[model samples]
Target: MTQPSDVLYYSHNLNPRVAVAVARHLRAPLRYVRADPMGREREAFRPINPNTRVPILVEPSLTLWETDAIAMRLAARFDPDFWPPARREEVMLWVSWSAHHFTSAGGVLYFEHIIVPRYLDRAPDHAATAAAEADFRTFAAILDEALAGRRWLVGDAPTYADFRVASALPFAEAARLPLEPFAHIRRWHAQLEEFDAWREPFAGLD
Candidate 1:
């Protein structure tokens, strides 16, 4: 049988959160195909992805778009434990906490304070930025308290939840979001950063 090839076509501006989670968990090295904002300009890419987002994953016979969806799919396929709780109620809790609370809150702060200035060449409005930052801090505080004595997000073991959250840290750092007092968060992030697969993906890009 032929081995499946894993490839991630992405850009520097595109963080590739889902790709990072899958790649790191599976210990699979990714082949990067850097495409312009205008996209690959090929009919092939157009058909595979309608929105034309970066971080498109091309497996040997599967093409996936949408970062979060791709991450969930990969987790289900390779590491079911990474997806969410095997129990239904816990799955609901994870989804509610991550989707409705964490990702939304973090995304606002990320887009307004970090992404806008870098990609759009202008900062977001002060009031809006302030609101988002407050949201993120509130969410972070809850996570920090939950992680008061634990090592990972879901359980003693790490999961995609940790990876998804960690992907936002570089942006938070870029925005000068101070983590000075959050010792557990700092330690958690440091642990995640030590992964060779995570660092390897950006080697040539940086």
Candidate 2:
């Protein structure tokens, strides 16, 4: 059987940006395809990802959805350092927390403040934004406490989990994320922002 080319279908959304940043960090020999699964190509992209999400990684005999899963595959294939064996479970701990708490809360704020007002051409839902801000502070406190002395989420260096947790930090300002009180998370995210890949993952995309 012939091996299929690794193609990453991505959008500029929070999750897809993480995938692009990972691929860029790894310098993986893969083709990048910009896709708008939720917008103009919703119907056309359904067959590729039934849930209609981007950051879909299509490799030989496999079509992967979910941002973390895509990041896991990319790390497992190109660089083990990003997903170290001994620290795998520890990394997963943070990834799970992000999906369940931090990122989830942050996504709501982004959607309500940024997405609703800008793309949807409607006023943001203030009630939802206020509720999300409360949740953001609640979860962010946990993250802030966790990062009190650590540079990264799991290991000595940045891991996939770090990217996963920091997924929404880049948009904190634009989304009006309630991050001002979380000094530790702000400090940690500042370090991630130093990286070109994290700062501008789509710098060269056409």
Candidate 3:
């Protein structure tokens, strides 16, 4: 099969690690378009995605703004291990849950600890962090219980669901995401790090 070379991946303000992992799994080369959250770059991206979010996938035939949707589309075409037909519903459930709950909470800590200090040159918001911490723990506990003896999120093998959920965990320590109580999640994330794609999701960004 011919890999798509004209694919442009826009990511800057928000993390695109999951998209990077999917690209790696597909062995597709992505032309990255970095958007600056604080500059005119975000405005420029509005036409592409009215939500003005990064990690937007643009190709000749399609434009995908949501990360889970992009993962599903790419996996449907390129990688079966990530998106088997029989497991499609389960995969979507986890992906949706990650976006609605997990990532929302994790984004708070990531923005406070990393994005604010590193990019925005500002102090972390204590009130926001406190609220996010509570939310993080609530979701983390649910995930940890689900992962009690399971190594993967959906099936025996690692799938898009695993990638979607674990995407935010790379910043766990740096973001102080209140993960110390979730051993199962930590173990699962460690297993994900064993994959080359997961380990270096942001490889060429420098």
What TM-score fits each model? 0.78, 0.93, 0.87
**Model 1, poorest ten-residue lDDT window?**
87-96
The lowest-lDDT stretch of 10 consecutive residues in candidate 2 is 1-10
Residues 1-206 of candidate 3: C-alpha lDDT, one tens digit per residue: 77655554556334566787777767666666566433567677788788777677888877887777788878877777788899899988898898889888998998899889987757899999999889889999999999997889998999988888876788788888888888999899989888887787556763
Candidate with best lDDT: 2
The global C-alpha lDDT for each of the candidates, from Candidate 1 onward, is 0.66, 0.89, 0.79
Taking every candidate in turn, the Cα RMSD to the unseen true structure, in Å, is: 3.4, 2.5, 2.7
Clashes of each: 0, 0, 0
TM-score-sorted candidate list, best first: 2, 3, 1
lDDT score for residue 130 of model 1: 77
Ranking by lDDT: 2, 3, 1
Tally clashing residue pairs in candidate 1: 0
